[model samples]
Target: MSKYDLIIRNGNIVTAETIIQGDIAIKDGKIAETSAGQSLKAIAKSEINADGLHIFPGLIDTHVHFNEPGRTEWEGLETGSRSLAGGGVTTFIDMPLNSTPPAINKKNLALKKAAAEKNSLVHARFWGGLVPENINDLKDLFEDGVLGFKAFMSPSGITDFNHVDDVTIFKGMNEIARLGSLLAVHAESTVICDQLAQEKIAEGKTSARDFVESRPIISEIEAVRRIISYAEATGCKLHIVHASSRKVVEVINEAKLRGVDVTVETCPHYLSLTIKDLEQKGGVAKCCPPLREENEVEGLWNAVANGEIDVIASDHSPAPPHMKEIQDGDYFKAWGGISGAQSTLNVMLTEGYVKRALPLEKIVQLTATNPAKLFGLFPNKGTISVGSDADLAIVNLNESFELKREDLFYRHQHSPYVGKTFNGKIITTLINGELVFKNGDFKKRAQETV
Candidate 1:
């Protein structure tokens, strides 16, 4: 019998702190040893000669909409997780909307999990919704092992999953704080968005530019300000999700400076695409809190470099083809989403690490470590340390690929980044010692533990 089940040798292992030339040994589906500057000499049943590749901890996307149970046609667990595995993601936190019945309480959470258990190719966790109807169920939901609660300050688009008002949020924040759970907000002001959208609709100005103008920067910043105040008062750990504006990040950073228990995440679409892409691509690129201008994109990049942004998630909300209104080319009538889950890592690598020279450590922090720590999955899921789940991705930094529609695993097969070129490639992905994906092909079913 072999001393270990698998050994990955002669690769550069990256962690949140540093990167080192190392070999990793896996035993019983856990990382047994990470030997730095030396190869593991232990006998193994299988060995991969990973020389010259960058071995990163498998990415944990903190936000995604798989839309299971009620909205699988939009994006189901199986196809969604396969896409994630192909992108080198081993774990993801599913949001509480889009899915029918929404994950508002223990029963709905169980229903979502049942669907996930049947189709998920990766480890998955759920987030409970903080809608007005579910304010009384927050405690039960948290105790049910939801990583956190998700709230939309503006309309969530799905009729069943309505957004929370100020009163509902104030009460929900207190409940979540009492339960020691985090609250992640889609922080766009409802009043501002509704008013502007109505005005634009009445004026017959429903173009991409009109949609962008409807949700001004102040809408996001104003909601961030309100959420920060509530978090401060209630002592809840607050996370602002998918912020697209530099001003929103500025508000979050200033709050952190003042001892507010807050963090912020930006999505790959926001960092990679600008209003130009939105104008050109039309509905496929349209998303809530629409993509900002080129200058704001530059500002967001600067914030990432300066450590003002805590995490970078996919926020991979996808809709059916008709929902995007690709035929009509009507931005206002289209469902707002971006199918970029499989492209998040590559976008960051190309735009941040390669072009802008962001350190590998920072990329790891944004993609894996910060999200893991925030959601209570750290040390187990986010690091390449001993005893952690053997979840990793072997990346060939020298290789490049241009994304295409056929390459996407999304059910809709539409993405804003379809034609973009990326520098780094996920050559292989391992989840819990199983080679789930290699060389652009799936090898096995994802080990769905948790």
Candidate 2:
């Protein structure tokens, strides 16, 4: 009889700390043993030759907008999770906006769970919505297994999910602290953005550049300061999502030094793309806390390299093409999002490693390890250690390919990264010791349970 279920041999194993040449033994979907530069003596039912490939932990994207149930036309759980698996992601936490009847209360959480049970291809969790009206709903959702609570300090771009004020923020923070759950905020002050946007519109300035200029760095920095103060006063663990500005990073670092229980995440778009790129791509590249200048992009990269930023996520918000009409090219009128879940790892590898020379271990940390720890899915989901889930990605570091919209698997074909050439390619992705993607094809497996 075979002693192991699967064996991956002759690969360079990369983790947050070091890289080693090893052979991994997996039994019943868990890592059984890992021997450096030597194959296991026990028999195996199946073996994969990973010669010349880099094996890293499957990515955990803690922040993604998988618009489903009520908003399937925008993007559904099926397509969203498929794209994630194709990019080497094994776990994802869905945000509570974009979908109608967002996951704010217990009723909404149940509805979202039912939808995910049918379409989710990998392990999934959800975030409860935090708004003024939903203050009473947080505890129930937390008890119901929501990973955290998500609040927007500014208008969330959707009317049903309203923005929160300072008063509501304090209340929500206290509630989340009581539940021992983290609060993730979209950290731009609506008061500041609304004022600037109104002034620009009055002046007949609605171009992409004008939109970027309207929401300045100060708006983000001011909101971070406010949230940090509240987090300190209430003893709430806070996570600022999609942090864009260098000034905001400085504030977060200072708060951490001052003993605040806080962390921050930056999206791949902010790290790889810039205001100049946004200007050239127009509405397709638009996002909230819009892309910053080239110098600011450099500062964000430095933060990622130095570990000032805690996690890197896709913020994979997607919308239909009708909403992002490039012909109109009016930034204020276009939908605010970017579709890059399937391209995050490759884009980061191309931009962070090839161009900037950031170490591969750091990329593993930002994309996989940190996110798993933050979302309470650690040990099992983020590392390649013994007793962990056998979820891994085999990467071809020397390969190169140009990103094309038609080649993507997302429900919407539009992408901000179209025509960009990337250096790394994911050759095979394994979930629970089973091949899910390989050789440009997706292998269907049994639906995963939450």
Candidate 3:
């Protein structure tokens, strides 16, 4: 009988710090050993020859809205995890919004967990919502094992999950700090965005360009500034999510230098697409704190290369075809989200590593390692080292493919990257030593409990 359950050999294993050509032995869902250029004596139930490919630690997406329970039509845990698996993601944390009741308290958390338990194909975690009305729910939700809390300074677009004010932010942050939990914010000033949006709508300008103009860079930066101050004052570990502006990056970097406990994340859309894509693609490319010009995109990329931006998540929020307003072509009326969980790792591999010459190690840090550390899943889910969970993404960097609607696994099956080609492709994904995805097919397993 084989001592090991499975062994993956001859692949270049990418870790947070280095790459090693090795064979990994897995037993009972954890990596038992990784031998570099040497064969292990233990036989295995299965062996995979992974020559000429890269074995990366499965990605951890810290931001996604798999609107479940209440709004599964927009995106459900089942399809969401399928999309994430296609992107080489092994674990994800769903946001509180977009879901029907929003995960604000014990009841809502239970509801979302029930939905996820029935349908999720990958390991799942959650972020509790922080709104003006839910200030008291922080400690209870944190104790309930939510990874963190997500608050919005600007309008969250859902009536149930309202944007928080300064007072509520202070109260919630104090509670979160006391409990040793992190708070991630959608840092955009509601006043600035609301005023600009109304002014543009009054001008009868509802084009995509006008939408970008409505959420000016100042709106985002100002909210970041306020949140940072509140975090510092309340002694909360703060995280700025979907940071799109270079100015926001600069501010966060300065704050970090000053010893503020903060980190920031950018999305693939900001790094790969720009305002031009918005103008051309219309509602599909529209997002809050809208995509900036080419220079800003380049600056954000530089920040990623420099280690200033800590994480890269898809912020994968999806809506129905009609919600995108694809037919009306009105950015103001469209839902402000991008269905991109499946394209995060591919885009980063193409633009960050292949074209920009960023090291594979850095990509691993941005896409997997840092997020794992930030969200309290490190050492287990984000590294390929010994004793880690045997979750991996095997990719062929030499291959490339154009993203089409048929390639999408999300419920809506639409994305702005529909026609764009990416350099790397995820050939297989292993979750907990199970071959869940391979060669564009998903082998659905029973839902995993946390």
Candidate 4:
């Protein structure tokens, strides 16, 4: 009889606390045992010799736009999950807006859930939408097992998924608090940004820099402060998504000090690429709360280093190339999203570990452990612990490669990161003991969580 179902040997196992030289054994889809220095002597059905590699708990990106159902051409669950698998991410929280019908009601949530269960190669949870008309639908979606609700404080580009105003957001937050659920906000001032953008375009200042300047730090700060007060009043667990600057982190941290149950997430683009990159990359680098100055980027990194930021997600909102026209197109009209699901780990490895000397434990905390805790999937999905799901990503930390479009697993196959070199190549990724991705190939089966 086999003592274990699988064994991975001779790797540096990274967890939230520290990195250890060890071997891990898996059986019946869970981590059964771990050894200090050598492979387990017991017999196993399969084995992976992960010598000379670093094994991390599979990354959990808590924010991504895998626009399924209606926006498949933009980014479907199948190709989206493939991109995630290629990057060694085992789980994600799909945003509510981009999918057809936005997952705001039980029917739409079920539609997206069924689509995910059918096509996703990795595990998925969803964020239900909070808009003016859908306040009554929160309980139904909550009962259907949505992890949280996402509300955009500014205009969500999709007309169907209208952004919430102060009254709606406050009401939604109160209802969510009553249900013991969470609410994530896209913090941007609608009125201020719209006015600024319109003024810029009216004056023919429609360049990338103009677009960047249109969304000011004051807009973000104003929105965040308003939402924090709402959460304070409602006692709702709150998450601020894609926090782009040091001042934003300061505001979030100050709220935390005031006993608010809030956390901050910053994307890879915010940490790695800056206005300089945006200027060079043109429309491809465009995103909401546009890239900041180099000083701002450094300040955000300092926030991550000082343990002020909670999670790091991709915010992988992608569009077809036609909608994302390059330099010749109007930057003001181009799609404002970055297709970054596949490069998050590489970005952190290069920017955090190799360049800035930030600890691997810190990276693990920001990218995996903290996100899992925030979304309530910690022990089962985030850490490589005994009795937890055996989701692992084996990486060659010494390797570096210049990202090519061919290297992208996204349906669009274009990113602000194209041609940029990064370290920590993901060699293999396993989801719930299944070998889903290996050396850029997939096993091609949907992940079903029991």
Alpha-carbon local distance difference test for all models = 0.90, 0.89, 0.90, 0.91
TM-score of 3: 0.98
lDDT of 1 by residue, 1-450 (tens): 799999999999999899999899999889998899997778899999989899999999989999998889999998899899989899999998889989998899999888888788888898999999988888888888899999988888899998888999999999999999989999998889989999998988888888899999999999999889998999999999998978899999999999998999999888888888988987889998899998888899999999999999998999988888744545788889989889878998999999899999999999999988988898998999999999898999999999988998888899999899999999898888999888878866644535
Residue pairs in clash, model 2: none
lDDT of 2 by residue, 1-450 (tens): 999999999899999999999899999999999988776787799999998999999998888888877889988998888888888888888999888889989998888888988888777789999999988888899989999999999889888898898999999999899999999999987888999999998988888888998888899999999999999999999999999977899999999999998999999899888888888888789999999888888899999888899998999999989887755546888888989888889878988999999999999999889988888888998989999999898999999999887768789988888899989889888888888888678876676556
Write model 4 residue lDDT over 21-108, tens digit each, in one string.
8899999889999988665788789889888899999999989998888999999999999999999899999999798778889999
| TM-score, cand. 4 | 0.98
- Error in Å for residue 30 of model 2: 1.0
Runs in model 1 lying further than 4 Å from the true structure? 326-329, 446-449
Question: Model 3: runs farther than 4 Å from truth?
Answer: 326-329
In Å, residue 183's CA in model 2 sits off its true spot by 0.3
Off by over 4 Å in 2: 326-329
